[model samples]
Target: MDTATASKNPDTRSATDRGLPWAEIDTVLFDMDGTLLDLHFDNRYWRELIPDEYARLHAHEPELARQRLFAEMERIRGQLRWYCLDHWVRFTGLDLLALKVRLERHIALHPHALDVLDTLRVQGKRLVLVTNAHPEVYAFKHARTGLGNHLHRVVSAHALDCAKEEGCFWERLQTVERYDPQRSLLVDDNLAALASARAAGVEHLRGVRYPDSRGPAMQSVDFHLLESLAELLPDRRLHAYASSPV
Candidate 1:
């Protein structure tokens, strides 16, 4: 059965499958950090190591350092600088990127992320890595994950001069990477970015319910949530990966 027709029929398997309708999607925009790679590295870096190190350097109580840093982060939470490592270095007087690179051992792909990308690549999908990460951060993660090899293009918000949380990001993204919003799908863990995509007319959105495997459950309330990218695969491939040695 055709995709649209299959989606309409309650008895059709497509209705039961949570995977994207590949036939209808042309370009697949993926969020690199939490959506593809495990988010724990960033979480631990920002929430744990940074705080501990900052407290050590500044001679402040551990709790005070975390509280101070959290307040500073809140002030620029959804802005581009929030993702800027240079800005963080200047603000915190810390060599953030070097610290991140040192923590690269913790960087890893989410389960089945590679398999899903392999399937999409062979199908000739336009896979784009769209991220709010600063270029330095992107480079480090790329070194660890080799995500650049699999993507048609890698876009950093710094290059666009806008964060994904902002609505204009989609328009700016098109200036460099042309895509039909209605025929595109974005798998992102950030709710703000998903909302921005929806507002910009992107047709499909999937949110990661557990972006940080080492952390608690995340909120993906307005958009469809996937427990893992494994859910994006067809039953046959999913079972194969599950049974295969990790």
Candidate 2:
């Protein structure tokens, strides 16, 4: 069934009122930090720890350091550089990679993310982890969480030199991944990335309701909402393949 038809079906409701045409989807693209993994680590590192570290390193007042860092973060908010650890190190004069390594304990997968991934894999769906994380950051997180075992491939925006917020990122991704937009589903925590994907002609899109485990749930206006990836699991009793523990 097409998405339009599935949307109109009253019986389609499950995790959300706007049910997806799961049967028609072949490729499932997932965002890394927020969608499949807990976003609290990233949020805490950037919002709290970075400011504190910057203050300590530069001998600036904590509040002042936060203000300065926040301004720089805002300046590159949706750009690829915002997600690049090397760019951040160069811009802030902070050893971000080292700091991330120090805080690797915070990196973790969201509940049931593995179950959903395993189910999709068992069902013969092409799974790709698409993230705006820098190559260095991706490596750090992947090493800590070992999420790579569950995915067919992982694509970082660093490789494309474009953030997922830009439609050109999707265009460039298509050249490399060669996914049929209509038959693919993208689950992301960022609305901007979803908008870009939609504009790039991707037919199926879903947004995470609660990206950060420590934060309140967000309402998604433009795409279907999911409380968790577990909602997409084919069977609640299905056991995921064993992998390196997070």
Candidate 3:
């Protein structure tokens, strides 16, 4: 798909706009961490809290112990095992929910995230959040962040028994949600997860890079490289007339 094409609205064409191949994407599935919210929360929680909690449990130097556990956690961040907060807490024996709440207290949504979600909802699109986070962790995050109000559904990989890296997870999500893959767009920061959805026949995919990052995204499944969800608003009207295959 030559995603860099001329948009229907000539006034609003971006330099990268060959335009997305699929005509109109209705169902937008968003990945939470790096896509909608900043990823520093997860990184800090595991790298800092897990070890401090462990040290408190064992009477060791909390700072030094945090470094040790952070090193261990860093080695497995991308693996499927790390996707589940419960599994991590079980192995490390930390109260994951308590730790998550700590992170959630400072957590905030990405700039324009709420605007984009609201625009899609106003346009009558079904907004489903497909995240790899455990139910409790995201639940706490949502309560604090107010992201729950913007989404139609929030489906976690834990409930599906498949992380995005696993083949059957996307299939299970489609089966349960009855979402049309072709007419849907899945946005995530994880390249592997985006590719997994692409392999499952999802046509439109976008990768979101964080606002503070100077580097490009580390993934290839992105049809659109979005700096923020707010970018969708101005040009969405162009796609309003373009009929997407349902």
| Backbone clashes, each candidate | 0, 0, 7
Q: Give per-residue lDDT, candidate 3, residue 155.
A: 92
Per-residue lDDT of 167-226 in model 1, one digit per residue for the tens? 889999999999999999999999999999999999988888778877776764488877
- Greater lDDT among 1 and 3 belongs to 1
Best of the candidates, TM-score: 1
* Candidate 2 pairs with clashing backbones: none
TM-score of 1: 0.88
Q: Which candidate is the best by lDDT?
A: 1
Model 2, 44-128: lDDT tens digits are: 8898778888888777476787788889999989988888888788867888888876667878888778777987899999999
Q: How close is candidate 3 to the true structure, as a TM-score?
A: 0.77
Instruction: Give the clash total for candidate 1.
Output: 0
Of candidates 2 and 1, the better by lDDT: 1
Each prediction's Cα lDDT score?
A: 0.81, 0.80, 0.70
Give the TM-scores of the predictions, in the order they appear: 0.88, 0.87, 0.77
Q: For residues 58-108, what per-residue lDDT tens digits would candidate 3 score against the true structure? A: 675766666666676778766656777666677667777867677665476
Worst 10 residues of 1 by lDDT: 1-10
